[model samples]
Target: MDDAVRLESLAKSYGSGDSAVTALRDIQVSLPKGSFTAVMGPSGSGKSTLLQCAAALDRPSSGRVLIDGTDIAGLSETQLTEFRRESTGFVFQAFNLLPSLTAEQNVALPVRLAGRKPDRRTVQQALAQVGLEKKAGSRPSQLSGGQQQRVAIARALVTRPAVLFADEPTGALDLTTGRELLEVLRKLVDSPADDGLTTVVMVTHDPNVASFADRVLFLADGSLVGELISPTSEAVAARMTELAVPTC
Candidate 1:
């Protein structure tokens, strides 16, 4: 499919009856293959909800989510688990690395859990993609926060997933380290190699972080309010400022 992810008439809600609260509403968007897109919103804007649904981490209460042109709504929970493991990759604010495992082991954890042999060279290549090839033997305890996050990225991309969804990936790092991480992500999307990682959808509050993406989507109150192409930090920040103001 030309679109890596497509959400059609999507909606999500919690509870039921009059007490129900909707987290996403009539969301429709298509993420083109090999493109980087960022999602931004004020608190309760459902930016995270959109990411989770699009990634198949959570099923929408209504509508359809298509990944690589296949509808996932019909998959059973058991099937969904396997589909996610095989088709998607994720990174988050927390590194979620196993403390006892070395970098290489951590990167290969997903494959190993899937009952497959962990390929040493493939794991190494994942680390090299994140510039952590030399630290493959290091444990999470031995690595800095940035290094740990890099290892997490390696782990996420090890399967060569069609898409990567990151939620505040740089939230825990220092400014310099965060930018370095962003560059790593940027490089992956811009890589010249065919069959390499090229699609990314990140959710973040930092305007600077959002600017690295080819486009930025803005959400407010569970709906997409606007989007910016070729976004700049100044422009993103200003839009965020406007989003923050309460409207009558």
Candidate 2:
């Protein structure tokens, strides 16, 4: 499989000398196109930092980050902005939708921000994929937690980005709702509609949530400690317990 993202000996640190703290330590990982991956770790393990660095939201103090064979470290700030805008999609625990905009409008915002006109048909299709077609006219306050999250997912996918980085995307929803959302994300990554190019990288502490991924990476103290492919909730939970890692 082709690599959508590659990180080699990546490191991030803060402060200097005695006050120095390392957030990520010589991390190396690769995400293949169309694969769904989960990052699991205890608090302070640098899972979030890894995601931020991989997504270009934060820079590493050393090493390399590549997206589609292009080293992100070589891009200027303006070029990085363009790269992120055109190649990455983000979903956070918070819906982050504009309160005044309807679901459809929020989903269309990215395309508009890129100086392109919104295509109504594309917006509708994206919303429909997440089963939010009927609520397309609803504002964030008008929808339930799950509905709002679905809208967020729709927004992330509308631009057809090469990679989707979701930080605890299902954190705010109930079990059934979170499961539904995971299914939607799984289908989005695995289905052919994305042209076999949309890679998914999610940070999650829930074993059930991690079960939805093709692979689960375990981190300890800012370094990768283990990996599980074709994981199950029970199996992952057992491993987490063995490692004394807390779950969400």
Candidate 3:
């Protein structure tokens, strides 16, 4: 599979000179198309930084962020905005839906924002992909938390973007609901025919959530520290424990 996202010697620092605090340091990694990768780390280890940079939500201080082979480091603000909208999708801990909009309207938002008329059939298909077709008329207030999140996922998927960046997607849901959401995510990546060109990069602290991914990328002290392939919850938890301890 081709690479959907690549970060080359990426570095992000806040402030300047003597007061500078680096949040990401020489990070280099590639996520191939259709892969689901979970990023795990301690509170200050740059997990959020990595996702923000990779997804073009923020620029890096130095190095490159390549999305689908296009280097975004030099893109103008307007160019970056258009590129991001056309090529990438994002989901956050907060559903961030318009409370006034129903599920079908919410799913059609990206298309509408891109200056195209929202297609009712497209909206229905997107909601159906997330198993929410029957709830298409429900407003955010009317849906359960998991149902709301499913709507958010549908919004992300409707764009048919090359990559999906999810930051703590299930953070607000209960365990069972979170697992159900993860299962939905897993099915998306698992089905190459439907989502073969899409890649998923998610920031999650829970080992059980990470286990749903194809691999787990561990970050520490603003660096790419370790990786686990075909991870299970037990293995992911063990790796997290190892990263927490200071080594001599």
**Candidates in order: C-alpha RMSD to true structure:** 1.0, 2.6, 1.2
User: How does model 2 score by TM-score?
Assistant: 0.95
Model 1 clash pairs are none
Question: Which rank order by lDDT, best down to worst?
Answer: 1, 3, 2
What is candidate 3's local distance difference test score? 0.92
lDDT score for residue 195 of model 2: 42
Q: What local lDDT does model 3 show for residue 107?
A: 89
- Predictions in order: lDDT: 0.93, 0.90, 0.92
Models ranked on TM-score:
1, 3, 2
Regions of candidate 2 where Cα sits further than 4 Å from its true position: 194-196, 245-248
lDDT of 1: 0.93
User: Candidate 3 regions off by >4 Å?
Assistant: 192-196
In model 1, which runs have C-alpha deviations exceeding 4 angstroms? 192-194
- Lowest summed lDDT across 10 adjacent residues in model 1 is found at 190-199
Question: What are the per-residue Cα lDDT tens digits for candidate 1 across 1-248?
Answer: 69999999999999999999999999999999888999999999999999999999999999999998879998999998888887888999999999999999999999999999998988998899899999999999999999999999999888888888999999999999999999999999898234654689999999999999999999999999999999999999999999999999
Candidate 2 lDDT by residue in tens digits, 89-173: 8999999999999999999999999899999988998898788999999999999998999999889888777889999999999
Better of 1 and 3 by TM-score: 1
